[model samples]
Target: MNYFQPKPISNFNATIDIPGSKSITNRALILSALSGKTITLKNILLSDDTQYMIKALRSLGNKIEYNESSKILKIIGNKNPKYDNIDLYIGNAGTAMRFLSSYLATGTGTATLHGNSRMNERPIKDLADSLTQLGVKVEYLNKFGYPPIRITSSGVWATSVKIDGSKSSQYISSILMAAPNFKNPIDISFIGKVVSKPYIHMTLTMMKDFGASFTLKENSINIVPKEYNLSEYLIEGDMSSASYFLAMSLISNSTITLNNFFKNSIQGDSKFLDVLLKMGLTILDFKEYSITVKGTSSYKGIQLSMNDIPDVAQTLAAVALFATTPTKVWDVENMRIKETDRISALKNEISKINGDFIEFKDGFLINPKPLEMYQGDFLETYDDHRMAMSLSLIGLKVPNIKVLDPSCVSKTFPNFFEEFNKIYRED
Candidate 1:
């Protein structure tokens, strides 16, 4: 029952390093397990989500060693992952649950993949349906679209798959990762316009890094079933988290430097620099690995569609509230299905602050105005780690905010409050 009380911040400082990205780390771990080669990954985020994936991988007879001192991961590949016929618990990691869904679909034995109470609620039928079409026997223990089910990987699969990409890219990524391992090459077509296209690109790029090949057509990806050979991989720093520090710099005139982050990262969230640039922030990149963002006086609000970088939507929305004018964001419908219904949650809190915000089915528009500060009330996290942390960025301006269920941050950034307090001020 730990709660985090917000401390107002006056001037934020320069230089802070967030851990390696959860996205890249999880992707690397899965690729390493599927790669059929010994691989070493440096600067990996050892959070709860990755830990769950590591446990699941080890349970499947793959050898995985994580070094805490150097933050290095050494992996011994498994050609045939020995499923011990145990229930794999993924907690609340959507990536772990989704990637594992596809990874185990290629296994020889029957394996069960499910998560916490929230995991069962998250929709996984999109992936399960795709796997079913590919000849994988996927059955739901409870509901058709939910988890807590049995997946038995048995026979040769389809030559191609028609996937509805409009819902989630994780569903597509899951199918794509396992498609190459199937007996047949997979061609994926979209049921509607694809959402979060960058994540699909990230999946493709990582697959290519492991010697996988593909041909992406107008609305399809054609890939021949092949092996993924692991090589040395160093994950990029989490710019999704870095966006908070970047936003802190913009709001508080702070100059912050982030390390091990590439300007040319395949991650779409790195494009947040362009968004901040539009907000009249000063950013200079000495090289791809290092950047300095300085707050400037030209901060003004503008409309943005952050569909590509949906993970940072909460932070951007908070930043918009502090902007020089009103802001509007679009293409966020997919965010509804995340760890929480983010749009509704933010609206509920903003209303309490006397803020002016308009919510839509897919997006929201907000006005820049001074709102009521947190009045020592208990703030709900909705079991979403980002919801707790992203709103912490707002805590710099709003005081007396107590975040209930503070430990929920362990799902992604475990030391969120510690890192936040390191940058806090007494007003």
Candidate 2:
């Protein structure tokens, strides 16, 4: 097992220009593909997940030109998808898998979407079942309610459909993005409380950006079937990746500035800033495109409902270790179904560092620890990018900390360690 052992530092004060938002990039790809015209996207992230989405689109006959060095992506949308009986492999990219399933279903072809072993484990029945309501033929080629599924649809024209959003908001976003491609207006009604509401809002915002008209009601969204307007767009910095640096600043008693961040961002993970402010981190200044956070005082642990920002759950877990009181993280049961069993991974890793935490089915309570006890232990990452990135914050203060399978971060932030090392100041 390969491990990365970053040297401990007393403090750090640096600026980091985080990469573009993965959620936005993938959504833009789908929108651009549907636009059937050339759309330019700037500052796009080139990672494992986004790459999978791009590759899948290319296989379906979409024209995409990506400049790696410039971080620009230009896609020529295919209004009419070509080819039949196509095969697409989206490796553990839940966004690509879910979004592509619905996107391809609105076409006149039979496409089989499969992925890595882990991808097949994620549930897709909710999206498939909802698509079926819209006159799409969805079949489970492998297991029921899972991936390795096949979709055969000449076209779908549905006015209204109900989807359960408790498990994942992607299911709803998938249907919403593809709604505009349907033959008629589509109304998506939520069966119950949605888990990640902000992500759904992001989808709505991006859909509107591409000229899709949609109306939002209490529990349903009405999207008018229309062609997406091909427009140039710039993706914002990833707020989920920013959480690790934000937590690093707090834990190491240092200040850090993140550039290319928006104050009014569509991403729900940006709410982590509000959570940090409540925990006593001082926001020195806020600009239109940048925000600076300083370690001004001791942190107080407070209970947080993380249903909306589940990606930051691991980040909160890492920060909870530095709190003066126990931190209660609740309403995030979905973390159990992520890249790995994140709840169990967090519990096991925290226990290895001598931190006290009570694991619950829904969430966990993290008791305060002065600092992670350094025993030169190899912290296992479970091949989950968030787990590796979030837990690496311990090395900012604790000694002899080594992160195993650090390469897992390539799934999103390819140069995470390199960017992290830039902030490391030896004193």
Per-model tally of clashing residue pairs: 2, 0
The estimated TM-scores of all candidates read 0.95, 0.97
* Tens-place lDDT digits, model 2, residues 77-105: 88758558999999999999999977886
- Model 1: number of backbone collisions: 2
Local distance difference test, candidate 1: 0.80
TM-score of 1: 0.95
Model 1 scores worst on lDDT over the 10 consecutive residues at 370-379
For candidate 1, lDDT tens digit of each residue in 1-427? 6778776665566466677889889998888888768999999998999999999888887899889999999998775465756789988888999898778877788899888888888888877888888888888999778988788876447887778867788888887776667777778877777888888899899899888988978878898988888669988888787787788778766667777668788888888878988888787655778887788744798787887888888888778877878888899898888888889988877666656779999989888775453343556779888778776666667776667787887876777677676665322
lDDT of 1 at 106: 72
TM-score of 2: 0.97
